[model samples]
Target: MKKAFLALMAIACCHFLHAQPTRPNQPATDPANTQAPYLKFPTIPPFHLLKLDSATYLTKDDIKKNRKTIIMYFSPDCEHCKHEIESFLSNFNKFKDIEIVMATYQPFSEMKEFNEHYRIFEHPNIKIGRDEKFFLPPYYNIHNLPYLALYDKKGNLITTFEGTQKVDTLMNAFKEKKK
Candidate 1:
């Protein structure tokens, strides 16, 4: 009986010793404890989208014509979306060789207002257009806001990033293709 009692005590002590006290230094139990989740744009589908400002529509053929491209979906009323654009605008020169097309599901009036409000005309590489009825989202299987899709010079999908990503990460991703 004494031996069994001592074994129980030892087990209890071990359990107690392993129990961690809640503190700042202690690892968090949240999902954020792991690295942030990243989204890669898919490569299976093709894109055929229309422009909001003009009658011209963008097809896979159109994208195939470019050496490289960046297709992004944004909203005129979205604060996060605007923030993403502002980030791109801040480093517009870095992507001088990359064709960028900004698509919005919102109305043309809103896109126009947003362009005017943000003074997007200053950015030579960004093309603002409407995506309300465009086929880009479905073509690329993108169901999230502020989607940034990168393609190679050969018109192949390189990567598609969802959500707000660090500009440096994106720049590095673009530069990696050169190597």
Candidate 2:
């Protein structure tokens, strides 16, 4: 009886050891799930984010034509992010007409605080909004704060910057032809 039980135990162990997990079939890859959605989507994404007021929303339609756009991803408390904004603001004349949309995944209060601290209200051209959908981060593959995506007047991507900002460099890139 003992031998029979030992043999059965050994057989069960062997069977279990050799067994493969029946993994569920993987779903087909969606176009949006590609390596870099932005690479596939070179143009500015159709994003709808909540404005700082938490009342109205900012969307693709809100973007003005004949104006270049800068979609900036930032954290309000981030010093680097603050510096980037300062750089842009100091060179305000160059960026005055550019539509600047600052989106943050941080809480609305922080966004509001940052806006007030920066006196963003003064610049109707610069909009700081809350990304309630959390879209721009993944869309831009943001690994650092203050990621800026510059789009041409035609709503086509020029290039991107991570962790830093140079006003002259941005202006040059914005003038590039789309690939």
- RMSD of candidates 1 onward, in order: 9.8, 5.7
- lDDT of the structure predicted as candidate 2: 0.85
TM-score of 1: 0.65
Off by over 4 Å in 1: 1-54, 58-66
- Tell me the tens digit of each residue's lDDT in model 2 across 1-179: 99999999999999997675544574335544445677778887888888876889998788888889999999999999999999988889999889998999899999999999889889999987888988888787789988998888888888888988778888878665543
lDDT of 1: 0.71
Candidate 2 — which residues are off by over 4 angstroms?
Answer: 1-33
The candidate that achieves the highest TM-score relative to the unseen native structure: 2
Error of 1 at 98 (Å): 1.4
Candidate 2 residue 128 C-alpha distance from true site, Å: 1.4
